[model samples]
Target: MRDRHLYLLLLPGLLLILLFRYAPMYGIVIAFQEYNIFKGIMGSEWVGFAQFARLFRSPDFYEIMRNTVLISLYKLAASFSLPIILSLLLNELKHLVFKRVTQSVIYLPHFVSWVIFSGILISFLNPIDGLFNAILANFGSTPIDFLGSSAYFRSILVISDIYKEVGWGTIIYLAAIAGVNADLYEAARIDGANKGRQMWHVTLPAIRPVIIILVILSLANILEAGFQQVFLLYSPLVYDVGDIIDTYVYRVGIQEANYSYATAAGLFKSVVAMTLIITVNKLVKMSGQDGLW
Candidate 1:
């Protein structure tokens, strides 16, 4: 009874999960039914795995899978690594004021919503009187429709993602770096280790556990290819390369009113993501790092 107040403090969060998360999960039954807004869940026709079957049979499924995986891999390589590099650089800065200012400037874009950022991106890559096009004109180069071209769309996605997230992503790594023992640095200096060698040997090894955990988490979400960013920036011209599972679900579900199909697709994604996390966690544990479990 002495800890009753502490338990009370946890009540709201527990209730939130029960009500908003677990309660709403009951609706997942509709994924096995021919869901109808008018007929409701109880009244809907039970289709079993028909929706999943249809999803597999669709020609667009393979293409969407390819695009989703490719884009996600691009982001995993660029967005993930850049942040570690940036955090290391930030930690090495001797000038506190410059470091703080640089951090603020780089992380500022993370506060901007994708909607507003997309609008800004659209203006710069318009290809006709846009900033890039104007610069190209001065150099006697032709205009390029970056967002409309399949050739450049994925690159743009990766680059813009890096711009918006790289700095913010560094926050976790920076925190981990900060927690590294100062005595390790002193030992490195005593051994005549230079700055770069100290960071590589002492700093990085200290934060290896954190990096591994993040890598596992990143792999778990490998199917999520940034729906909002792609939806805002893509057109039919680039859909061949830019269309992902989320965008596909939005189109097939919201636009075409295929509720059951959409649910099946979403559930499939969730299962795959869960499997990824489990597999990665096992691999990490085998490699001698602690797992999320």
Candidate 2:
């Protein structure tokens, strides 16, 4: 009875998840059906495994999967490591105002919607009159189409992703780092450790659990290379390098209206993602770290 208020505090979030997250899950049935718009789920013709088989048979499926994995891995690697380095550097800044200002500057990009951000990016990278081309022109070089070029698109995606989210990840780690015992740092200093050594030995170890948890989550979500960002920034020329599972689903499912096939593609990605979370969580537990459970 005493905890009733605490439970009340949780009710809104629970209700939100049920309404927006779990409720839409019923649509997963479309993966197994022809899914006519006029005929509802009950009235749709069922064809077991046909959608999956069709998806597997498509020539583009392998290329799409490969691109998704590669781009996701690129983002994960850069996003995961740079934040730790940044957090450690930020923690070392004894000047309180400077640290706060630096954090605010970096964190500002996280709030910008991908739509607006991508427009800014597109304008900056425009082959004819973009900021980058103007810079190149100053040096007497021809303008290069950064976004359209397959060679540069993936790199741009990774760099832009880092620019946007690295600070947010750093904030999480800084919070974790803040919880480390001051005595641990003192002990490290007493043991003749320099500031760098103290951070490596005391700080990083203290936050290993948080790092592990984030890694597990990142790995599980490895299939989801950013949909909105890619949808906005990518062009047909760069689609060979940039098309991920989510974008593919939007094009085929939403635009082309091949609902069943799209659902099947999405379902496959979800199943793989679920398996990844389970497998990675189990591995983390085996290595004696706390899993998400």
lDDT string for model 1 (1-293, tens) is 99999999999999999999899889789899999999999999999999999999999999999999999999999877899999999999999999999999999999999999999999999999799999999999999998999899999999999999998999999999999999999999999999999989999999999998899899989999999999999988988999999999999887999988998998999899999999999988998889888
What would the TM-score be for candidate 1 when compared with the true structure?
Answer: 0.98
**Candidate 1, which segments miss by more than 4 Å at Cα?**
none
Q: What local lDDT score does residue 117 receive in model 1, on the 0 to 100 scale?
A: 99
Q: How far is candidate 2 from the true structure (C-alpha RMSD, Å)?
A: 1.0
RMSD of 1: 0.9
TM-score to native of every candidate shown: 0.98, 0.98
- Cand. 1 Cα-lDDT: 0.94
lDDT of 2: 0.93
lDDT of 2 by residue, 174-291 (tens): 9999999999999999999999899889999999999999999999889999999899998789878999888988998879888988889888988999999999999999988899
